[model samples]
Target: MSREEVKLPDLPVPTALDADEEAEKNLTTAPEVPVTPYTPSAVTPWSQDSGVATLTADTAPGTTVPVDDLPIAVGVPEGADPAAIDGDWKVDLAAPAASQDAGVSGMIMRVTPPADADPAAQVSIAVDTAGFADLYGTQAAARFGMVLLPNCVMDSPDSGDCAADGGTTTMSG
Candidate 1:
């Protein structure tokens, strides 16, 4: 008759529930958020840009000269009417294809967009910075533009591997 019996009820060890007090006592069962009502997509006319084009001839290091008309600032499709998106506005300066490791001799230089910047969403080109200071000497110059949108034209044009758009400045010697 050796029994160590009859002992019960002293429970208090289940911890782990204070996610902000179960989301302030809502007792967790959340997640179903979606409010929807803004619908606005499908306005692609033209867009392909690059920046920085100063030194409009004569900073005098080697005689600068790197602004053959390049003004690009676009975005007008909300209510749409930046003057019916102005003129034909074609711009084709392809790339620096003049060989000799791109020292200048490329083609496709169809430009126009500076009649006082017309309606002003912007699109200006006239890049032919002749001899651009004996091949990039005065520093700073990069202009790669592609903006020809008659009406809803979308062509990726396969650049696949990529490395055509250019940029290289700060070379004074």
Candidate 2:
């Protein structure tokens, strides 16, 4: 004997009103507060030194502080494109032999030891094309970027190639 084919029930289409129904129907009315007109004070203003003693009378007690807005550039070899960075870049602050530089755009990340770590064991973090690219994407390498060799990890999972001495780095972006 031939068996009859089973038919599935059709799902109902949502009505236009159902789709446009307002989920929140709160109708709160705030209590009205009578606002008084603001009037200027008729009394005279008090003197600055009336309550407090004058700290300086003969000379102004202030010193000018110089701020250097000059950009601090990292030492990258001349004519070397920053986009070409695609390897493990190690930065040894003591020796300076592993010190290499490259250009960047969006952001730069580095890895460093924890605060409790020994001061003498501090190592410099490095950023490569893949690291930089992963950070700001490949487009960032095209533009001019600065290097920021952080003394510690940025606290991000996908930051640089790897953590310096297996430490984590945090990412701002």
Candidate 3:
């Protein structure tokens, strides 16, 4: 005896209204969101004491203070003409000459005094920019004491592969 094959009927296609209703049902009804008006507050300047600077702001959390508003002073020594110093300042970390082969193994910021300025002049560095967090991670800027920038290194000093002949040297962070 041969068995007969049973065929199933196809589902009916949804109409436009049905589709619209389905969409409407799936959509989330936006809750009544209350809007809050922003009110500006007074700006509190940063204060420094005993080489430690404290930044205080009245703005809401996650708000960044403007870079120009930071109270950072790079003190030039007395009788040193600020005009003689180079406007282009470069900051980096350097290891001692004995540790030059080790490259910058530590976090010490060395800022180059302006060219033509007094070599013995005192210089102060302050950083309060948004990029500060990105550049130094969570490290405090005050922890980095000033040091004379060292000559560039060709490669990782710890790598033990740096060329003896002074090849093109790049400053390691």
Candidate 4:
């Protein structure tokens, strides 16, 4: 006996959306969010009301100021009283002046070693803006001296690597 083969109808894939169905799916609705006005406050010194700086530690002898509450002094000459200075007090004006000295002609910043430090080994910070400008170009060197008392290292004494304590040297010119 021979068996007969039965054929089944192919079903359609459902991906296309009808306009009415699409409109309902993408319906516009206004969200009912509560509206409230935000009031802003001003930032003032530690003495100001509602200022963070106004809050201080209770157990201190004097006014225990917060880290952010400390005042800054700017524009005053070197060794000036910090309290007497005002207006963007943190700004530094005295940068190491550039030099053309035969040795390392650059901005020289003198740093006094601690009194207890080796008396013969004082350390002075020096920056060679010209050398930097020559090597790295002005774009990179322009802001080189902006940092206050920038740390610098020398390959040798001619580059001001020698001890800043003014030690005598036997090497002749």
The candidate maximizing TM-score is: 3
In candidate 2, clashing pairs total 9
Model 2 misplaced stretches (Cα beyond 4 Å): 1-104, 108-112, 131-173
Summarize candidate 4's per-residue lDDT along 110-137 as a digit string, tens digits. Answer: 3322234334421222222332343333
RMSD of each: 18.9, 23.6, 17.7, 17.6
Lowest-lDDT window of 10 residues in candidate 1? 149-158
Q: Is candidate 2 or candidate 4 better by TM-score?
A: 4
Q: Quick one: RMSD of model 3? A: 17.7
lDDT of 2 by residue, 116-162 (tens): 43444322222234323333333444554545544432333234643
| lDDT scores of the candidates, listed in order | 0.35, 0.31, 0.39, 0.30
Candidate 3 whole-model C-alpha lDDT, 0 to 1: 0.39
Error of 1 at 63 (Å): 39
Question: What TM-score does candidate 3 reach?
Answer: 0.27
lDDT of 4 at 27: 56
For candidate 3, the clash count comes to 2
Locate the minimum summed-lDDT window of 10 residues in model 3.
48-57
TM-score of each: 0.20, 0.16, 0.27, 0.18
Candidate 4: list runs displaced more than 4 Å.
Answer: 1-98, 103-105, 117-137, 140-173
